[model samples]
Target: MDDTSRIGAAPRRAGDDVIQVHARLRSMILDCTLEPGSKVTQAELSRLTDAGRTPLREALRMLQQEGLVKAELNKRITIAAFDLDKLDCTYAYRISIEAAAIRVTASLLSTAEFDELDRTLVDMGEAIERRDRDEFEGPHRRFHQMLVSHVQEGARARMAIDADWAERVRRFVMQGDQHSLARADAEHREILEACRARDGVRASRLLASHLARSAFYVAAQLEPTYDTILTRTALRMVLGDELAQTAK
Candidate 1:
């Protein structure tokens, strides 16, 4: 019996291995450590993840379900390729869903939640000073997660995946200058203020605008001709034409 078969002898331990490998693979893909649109063999993955055949196959299935990888005829897996159109679609979905969710979530935040958000903002500022993208991302993601913590699990899960994609694109493309970082920090504070005031409508508009701006900027960097129609439409839906016009 192989090492995988040995591990499979214990059902519970094997199950845990599957979950860990799944998470590891997912993170590697999202972080671009595996590279988008690259063809990878199962042997390569097993070596990279330290996962045996059984667990690696199980984990690949999970990633396939998430649409992160495609199984091929010859057995190599294709990582999902990055595209400008998909980026717009992803941001559009985030703008629509997160805007609506935050409208409800804004008024529901407790004082403790507000305090936590403040700390995240502080952490983000420190990360900016250090010029560390990885450091900034943790608190930055947590800050957004907290905004919709009261929502249904399914919606939150979808939003989390989209958020990961958005962050990945940002890291892959735009190299931030100090000016842009300061602007983003200010935007986060503004959104937090709206939520703190319990103004769901304003908070929703701010969140939508924030997401739209990021989408537009990233799209422009990659392909200036590619109009982000879906993202623009979603922003207009959340913020009316007049405000949406001003948002860009």
Candidate 2:
């Protein structure tokens, strides 16, 4: 078995064991160490996380609900594959929602809140200079989350789901080229400036464009391998069939 399978074979107790296992497995998938379309078994996951079968099963089920895993015939579960069209759709939604959230957040910001955002931006700058992807992603996520969570509690929660989608795209880009990381860092600066200016409208527009640009760049890199039809169809199914129907 491979490292992923090996990691999948560990064990755990209950309560936090279940959450810890889920986070570990999810991190593996997001980092592309697990790869899209990889097969997952509860038995293997139990070994990887050192958790019991019951918790492993529960973790997998939760991942499935989050669109990170898919159940196949015969009870097998596979990591969800990358689909450009679905990614594009997700980018579109993220741009719109997050921009709006930022705008709202900016409108309501206090001195302390602005200072916190500024500090996060500085941390991002340091992370970039150090070329630390791991360090960068944390504060990067927090900065955006703070902006959105200030606007609406639910906004951050919804964006958390979208973050998983973004991670899939990021993993692909990082695997292919390191240059993309610099571009992302630069974009974050622009976002920070807009927020600091307290120009909600401008911030919103910039945020939208920033998100779109990343998707466009990643999609360009994936073009050689991605099937347009397959991506579009998959995204339509995910958005319409799953998310849409579930709300009904």
Candidate 3:
């Protein structure tokens, strides 16, 4: 039997191999290691992730479900093209993911986790001060991931499953928008303060607005009209009375 049919014949780590390959592939897809909208073959993936073709194909199938890749007419895989038009919705979705995570897990997070979170934020601040995107990106992602990790394993996994895409987009935006990065850092500090106080409501609201601001800013870089109405509606709901007061 080939590797595919022989997986059951192999040890349990064969299944584990599929998962590891999938994670690496997902990271590559999001980090632009594979390049956006570029074609990738199974052989390429096998070589890249150092897995057998069977597990590589398994990883590819999972990625395809996430909308990160698709089979071409020639049977090659194409990295899913990013639609700039979706910026507003992408922004709003990220807010929802983060807001839900914070609300559900704020009280559950251990004090030590909070300290680690604070340290991560401080690292981000230092990276920002030094103008090091590489440094900032790592801590920034860890901060968000740790924020979600306070919840149940399943909840955290679900929250993080699609995060690679957001990371990729953020890298794109941060590369050219230092002003926005500064604003984001200030917002993050506010968020950390709210979390430190154990005020879930304030933390959630601030997070929504903070995310909305980034979404709108990035969307505005595009046509400014595409997905504007939907994003604004979502943000207002997140902002609640604050949005109305701002309008007046």
Off by over 4 Å in 2: 1-16, 73-75, 129-132, 149-157, 224-248
Please, what is the whole-model Cα lDDT of each candidate in the order they appear? 0.85, 0.71, 0.73
lDDT of 2 at 86: 84
Predicted structure 2: clash tally? 13
Best by lDDT: 1
Clashes of each: 0, 13, 0
**Top of the candidates by TM-score:** 1
By lDDT rank, best first, the candidates go 1, 3, 2
TM-score of 2: 0.72
- Per-residue lDDT for 1-248 in model 3, tens only? 56688765755543348889888887676656777779877767667777887787788888888788997666589988666556566666666767777977677788898889889978998988998776887888888787667667876676575465566677656754768678778888888888878888778878778766655555666545656666566666666867624732
Tens-digit lDDT track of model 2 for 31-53: 77787878976666666677776
Give the alpha carbon lDDT tens digit for every residue of 1-248 in model 1: 56776764644543349989998788687667888889999988888887878998999999899778999988899998868888889999999999999999999999999999999999999998988777888999999999888899999999998887687665554353346667778989999999999999999999898778777877776678999999999999999999988877
Error of 2 at 171 (Å): 3.9
Q: List candidate 3 stretches off by more than 4 Å.
A: 1-80, 84-90, 244-248
